[model samples]
Target: MNHDTDAMFRTLKPAGLDTTVAEAHARRREQDLAAAWDATGSGRGVSAPAARRRMPRVLVAGLAAGAVAASAAFVIAATDGSGNSPGARPTASGTVRALDARAILLASADSAAKAPLTTGAYWYTRERETHFVAPMKLTEAQQKEVDRKLGTRLKGKTKADKSSPVTAWVSHTQESWSGRDRHARTIVGIDPKIKFASPADEAKWRTLSESQRARLQLDVPAEPHVNNYDFSHAKLLKTDEEKQVSALAKLPSDPAGLEKTLRKWYQDERALEMSLDGRTSENSFAAYVFGEAQDLLAGPLTPGAKAALYRVLAEQPGIRYLGTATDSMGRKGAVLALGTNGDDTGPIGKNFEIRLIVDPRSGRLLAQESGDRKAPSLTMTYEAMGWVNSLGARP
Candidate 1:
């Protein structure tokens, strides 16, 4: 859309500027977004003058909608204060002042988190994952669930002093019953790079953070309520540096039936794309895939890891199994063909594309790509979205 997709994505963050005002603004924004979305159909959109024939009505409408929702247009034109909202000011990154997810959550506990649930407490779902990293040790109640997720002690660890790279105990619970029908999902994490002066200096933050803090309550809003929250604020890291992959590597290298896991991720990413496609956006098939996608993405690769990778690549959407092959990187990776002509994928007919190249030696998405926007496809380089300093070459 004419509205920079990146900017639109930013507006969807856990907002707290105004509760009542935010909701009203949010509803109108959703409508504008939907209308803007309608204009992007491969076809079936409004006609444009010769000068703008290539652009869809959706793009134009989305720009207008975004301006209304943000309450002000973020013109690409020069600005003095970077891009942060007025009065909110901007950090070096153009976001609010520094403080990683870890510190922010701890400080926000007394303010944002409600009683019984406790402040600094949050429920997270990463494709069925219940584990999270924290900056501090876990509280007794929080440790129970963390232990449940870890499935065992940290190999000779004590309750008082456990050796976790990121030390913190967080909770994950399912609220089976609620007074209201709507569901509530909150995920709050920390990012050490945020750099707080010290506990005392940081302690005063809960008040300074009145605008950005998230409340641990049921039924906030998002067209699709993502139960996932990146408490780590690690989006800045490149794929090669993501903290979890190596941790997965530490697990038993000899994995059996790894196909199930691989296929799960393929299904998850594929289904998610389709659901996001807006055609079958409401189907269980898509939802089911998303529900399991994250579990499939992460791991302590068991004896079943490699096989799972092969199997999933064997069935990934827009992928054609080209049989076993090696990549230019010389990693013993498999090659998968992307695009509608894929024998296994049939025709998505959408303009999207995908490429999954893995290191067969270690079942990992060494490099991948996907998306309708060709310059920097969604494939594997999430570093796109222009968030990073560079957008690596696409295969």
Candidate 2:
């Protein structure tokens, strides 16, 4: 396998979780792995569309713990392109010239606390996702194996045929609307305009067979279909969405109370994990809370609760400021990262970073990125989020 593909599998497994819970998280990881494989034109000939099906929310619950653990190998990069350290404090002019990760989180908490609340019939959100697929570098034998699987015979006679690897950028957009009645609708639009590294690579791609191209996941339908879900039966609805919405209504506003409540929830979740697999996790409590907060930040949160979550993040260790950067949607925001690169005797022995870009003015989460610092393997940008009166509306 190529380095990119190998790196993906190495980083996919979550540390400190047993096979049972890890398998649940694997559903999502499989999609990502398949995408990378398809982009590289290696591995089993599974179409990206087939592997890109969205997993159920039941499987999505408690994913933050694993995600945070997967990023434990992240090495800190330079802070803000400035020679300053991550502990730098903002100047007294009220302008954030250079601020530490803790200070940034604190400022975001203050902004979140004062944010205005809104209400509507449905909660609407629009997000863009980009997955970078590195070029596949295969040996002659590996290329032959790929050809045999696809029933193709394109010999490397020309220089173009012998090109080292072809790089691809895969991107898509997803929109969702969830009502107070527990009904939800989701739409996923795959971007047809995939960017290639060079015209030579594009030319090489056209020479492949139709089936071979399909395995590349480039033939996705431009018009996305809508998926609907009904969860009106409160007693029967035991999904994570139900739990999240229910919890949002009752979360304590104060930071102390919120932290206390979250800890109780964490203990309950850990207990459930122990009951199911009989394995206890060695992950830090702060890391677990940080992961949970990361997931909750995307949902409809009360201003006070959101503020408390930010404050909770401020207390966690290993967080560093990455300065300002533009998200996939071309919006500028302050980037904060949490991770460390060191010898970890965990299930997954690979290292990667997780970054969260926040709008300092509104304390809104703009985007999230994960993977190596040079090129993120996965990036999710929040284009729009708020309450809407109708299912087809945007906020």
Candidate 3:
């Protein structure tokens, strides 16, 4: 990536934005990513034309924005060239026949519909998030600027060693406890660790002060930050707090009815956006519905409603089954890919793919991953989720 793009990525602070503003920022970021990828080739056999293919506008928009809006798409592909439909099932002869995406999702929906409903004082969730940073060389001017900003000079390397870049991964644990009465608390433990590609990289990293490292988005305080939110007064989601909580049980329980209700909501939202901005993209309806479904899944919902969401997902286009895989937490589940031609390349760039791992038996989402198939750039794993009696309690 270019220096400007890298700097923009490092400086993004979306914590303060409302839902609408955050979505706008997310769109701009996607455009920036596409532009950056175009300027600098991915060198992964993905041609410019293929990489620039107009994927569904809102593919994974909800996941990218870290908000409760529209989410990504999932494609369907046949595993054994059988061209099975959504109701297809595995063979009974003990021979392993890979099931299609629709079948997997439909089965999950059935399981979800049977789940027992429970209530508690708070809806709690624990998640682990990881972000991978690739190595990139910096220009001499960039290096000097960083050094000056940090008030330190490199130990050696007058000019020749600027070609080296560092490789590292940053990760953190996030927990949330939300109550139906519009009260919520979120805690984020920012733990960033760096692994140098070489001794030179390590030396360069070691020269920076702790504050400087934090400024560069390389380090953060060891302590966890807690934030309290009063949803009644906050503009968080598209709907108000009362509706958001009430819809958990009030949403349609049948697939067709649920889809219809969600479509109406999408149309109303778009109409409002068009009236305000004079124009709104019409390609994001599917993404918006999926995003809403995802958001509802994170909260307490009736089993029928949850199952309806899975059925709705099964009905989408371009969903492909990637077989089964283990999540970041080492839990095995069925995997699905979206917005791709059954390859690593997609609208984002070469070696990048949007994937979701779902637990079919329990009809729960295990993880969402984006980037390289071997090593994704971002991975969000659901460690635990359920109703708890108190804020700090786990499932």
Candidate 4:
């Protein structure tokens, strides 16, 4: 394996974005609490607004899908007014100017309250992930280690850190479906061909022998891998939607019970990803839960469950509202974001932001994305969701 493969592997793990979005909001709440702390300590209140953050530039490619329910296209333009995106557009002030983040979410909750439950034989969701790679050099020892692990000799000229770097851009399409019966399928692979971002990188790749490229996994002919899962009973899928939605249906529509249940679910998922305990502070756990809520939406969500989700998010701190913009699928929606700085162990070890895109008109979620100024970013646009009578059917 070359430096590119090493870098890609490094990027395949869950990172600080999960914490950042959660922590960013947690810090805001802390500040509010700290104001009371200050008053108690010095007999005077200290007021400070959370720092305004800038959204990173994002490049969303066009999406094309075969027969599917709901919308198929996904596209998100940069909201920073940087003019760096082809999808960027000036926000129309007349309609959205009066709406704040909380107002937007409240409206969303109202919309969700009226939404209907969907039932089908299968639930389908299609999305795309784009990875941006920069030029990198690999040492000879590093190349040998990669070769040893793969049991194949890499045929590339090895050089130290000072050599010319090679880089490529790639995108992957992922499709997943869960059935009302007892089956689930996920297909993931690079859909479009990989392209060298820099012409110099392209030239460098062309200089390599075809065998070397194959060993390096630099060729675009590779197929994406598929993973299939089947469950004999819905109880086996109880970790997520199956559990949460079912619980929501039993709980009262009041916010307190709703919040407690959702928070418990968040704690459960967080425990799976990281170690935490009674002493562990709940810094952006709510934000993390907000991000995770989309997965439940892909399944069946009752109107009360949907409204509870929006209401919980409306109360969370650190959610920044960016006026309407198009997701990668070309659907217009309002954008809310939270994030934190990336560390050495984190994937995309640069500062990144996680954004939730919600349909402004219907208050339905459209997409979610995590991106940074450097390194690759991931955006998941929900094309179509709902139950179908059969595996291949769409609703």
Candidate 5:
């Protein structure tokens, strides 16, 4: 196995509750990870569509995840690190096919690489410096705030998600205590309005049956709002155009390009500077995105300008197509809608539109607009979209 893979396997784990939960909350603050769960065109798509209009009432199913920090049996990576198994490949496609029940647990072994963590190599790295990670004491007052923000109840969630009142522990490297003691305890719960029509609706939910409330609040609403449409499924509905599952069975064996943009768009030093203040709320969110986007989305592109597209889109999860359009740079671009990867998938109120401009001829990005994915998914409407001829049409 490659040295990186060996090191990755040796260092990774699901992480303690404080680490996992913090990682979740931190992802929310980054522009890219914030969009992952939405139906818009992922980093691979060409256009930005408008967010669908949604009804005032919407169903919001909550999600949470957790991991117990264990030594011994849990420290190993993969079902067995036997030679070049399928799980070793980092391709964005079907690496999961190799996993059976045993591999599933091993699959999560590296889940620790994601952000909202503040240890090891996590504190300072490239464009990800926009994210911050520096271990600090979890105070009593701070724990409550974390619970309030997690906004996704963990009762049915994962172990870290379920660990309540937030107990935090740290093993202080493999040399530290080597037993079942927790390094940290973390609890997560849904925001008050996450399900109800509004805060007032929350009151009504308390009076409603648990199943009734769960069912009513979990149905993704369908309104005229642009955010309501799932661009991933749009072609299937026939209401929109068709976009086939990627013809490339697996994202290129060794995709490239993302590192360039992050290096260019957000200077590494500045991003790192942000990390220097790791205790701030913004640092947590930034760190989450840095870690998640680094491995989860990066390194799967074909190359050149397309690589840049993959980088931006990989980070912006809820982005979708808004059809063809010209950009401020006057390069014709395919507009894509944007949304927050937030639990609410229905109509997102306010600004939530993200746009990307591509050179129609070279397929290079000319300009970009990353907006909220709620209402106004695009700053430019579908009709307003067109190709920009840097060369004159008359000529």
Candidate 6:
């Protein structure tokens, strides 16, 4: 219905890939799109939760961590978009109801517009996630070398534990804080270990008749010594943070203007980033849109900016309305789907998707989840956001 919106969506999709493998790599890259926002401390003004110095590793490692399977789809549409029939509305805690995705998003836009404008000395986000990990093969010497380089010893305690690679379903609580001109800081805490001993154990596990790992209650080891940590050493220059913050603060509040401005912002960011490497790719559009959405949700935003962001999302192609659902934190909200619209027509075609969970009453973002449904899912929740006067302060 809206040509401008349609153009924006078209602009976001990368041109067709040369090979199925290329397509797979692109989809895999899309999963990490959100993490880039968390790691970028320059150009566009959003700061990763850690200093700029750690940019490369944070982007690469964080995004690669949770490659998992998606849960069953939670939202189902109840009505076809038609003027003759009003969509069904369900009462809270009652049966599922069908509603148009556009309507839900527009309603959210109105709600977002009414939210109070907020900012803080620091931009803060907190998240808790559960994901699976397959062990890496490292000899004793190699493990020691890794610890030497990282300044931390990470050996398994028992001889058997050290010899075997571990398969784990790890749960961790993480927090990030970004302030003007200072490095972003991140703190991470892990739950007690739920390890599968080693890859050998997992290999042997395959011989079992049932592959449902959930059926077996695994043992929880005490928190590993190297797991609980905090870091602020990454360097984020004030000038860079200020430049990005200034740019973000200046974004237009209307959808058309917002789209235009964001496109330019993303372009400039990519150019700045790629100028160092002397290579550039045009297929980054869709991924940039996804990353920008995550960035705005985590960064300082006025109510107007928030409203515009929601409207932008509502306009994107393949953004489906999945009705009410709860986040990993057990917060109930409506969910919207993006990137997951693709099917397995090509290699790794259906491997990427992002789900945004938002509070219907206030249009506040509750959480963002992306990655494969069958692998380790990466979920980041907006546990806290707002203007605070101090870096370590919580809003």
TM-score of each: 0.24, 0.63, 0.62, 0.58, 0.22, 0.57
lDDT of 2 by residue, 251-297 (tens): 77788998887777767766865765465454466656654654567
Q: What digit string (tens of lDDT, one per residue) describes model 3 on residues 1-395? A: 69999789657956455777856643443343223222211111100000111122222221122211122111112122223332222343323333567767776787798899877877887776655443333345544434443345675754323222334445677788877766888887644445444576577767768765664445645789888877756765453432455456577889998888778777776676576556654335454554454456656777898899888988877566765555555555666666333333423333445667677777887776554445444556677788887767888
- lDDT for model 2: 0.55
Q: Please write out the lDDT profile of model 4 over residues 1-395, one tens digit for every residue.
A: 69999899769856777778765654443333222122211111100000001111231110001111122122244342332222222233211123356756766776677777655556666665544433333345534433442345536544322122455544566666665555766666637456665587798878877666554445554677667666654454234553532343454356676788777765765564354222322336655555555555444666677777778778877666654556555655666766532121122222345666776446577776554422323456666666556654556
Candidate 2 contains a number of clashing pairs equal to 0
Candidate 6 local lDDT, 1-395, one digit each (tens)? 59999999878866663467665643433322222212211110100122223322222222233321232222222122222232344324343334555656666677788887766656666655443444334345545433443344545455333221334454555666666444455665534333343576667555533323323222332442222222235554432443354456666888888888777766776676566445443334545565456567656677887788877776766566554545555555556665533331211234445566666567777766554433323445566666666656777
Over all chains combined, what TM-score does candidate 2 have?
Answer: 0.63
Q: Candidate 3: lDDT over CA atoms?
A: 0.55
> Who wins the TM-score comparison?
2
RMSD of 2: 17.2
Q: For candidate 6, what is the total of clashing residue pairs?
A: 21
Q: Which pairs, if any, clash in model 3?
A: 60-72, 70-291, 71-291, 74-319, 75-318, 75-319, 75-320, 76-319, 76-320
Task: Write the number of the candidate with greater lDDT, choosing between 1 and 2.
Answer: 2
User: Which scores better on TM-score, 2 or 3?
Assistant: 2
Worst 10 residues of 4 by lDDT: 43-52
Q: Write the per-residue lDDT of candidate 5 for residues 25-134, one digit (tens) a residue.
A: 43322212112111122222221111121101111111110111121110101111223332232223323222221222111222212212111201110110000011
Candidate 3: worst-modelled 10 consecutive residues by lDDT: 43-52
Whole-model lDDT, candidate 5? 0.26
lDDT of the candidates, in the order given: 0.27, 0.55, 0.55, 0.49, 0.26, 0.49
Ten contiguous residues minimizing lDDT sum, candidate 2: 42-51
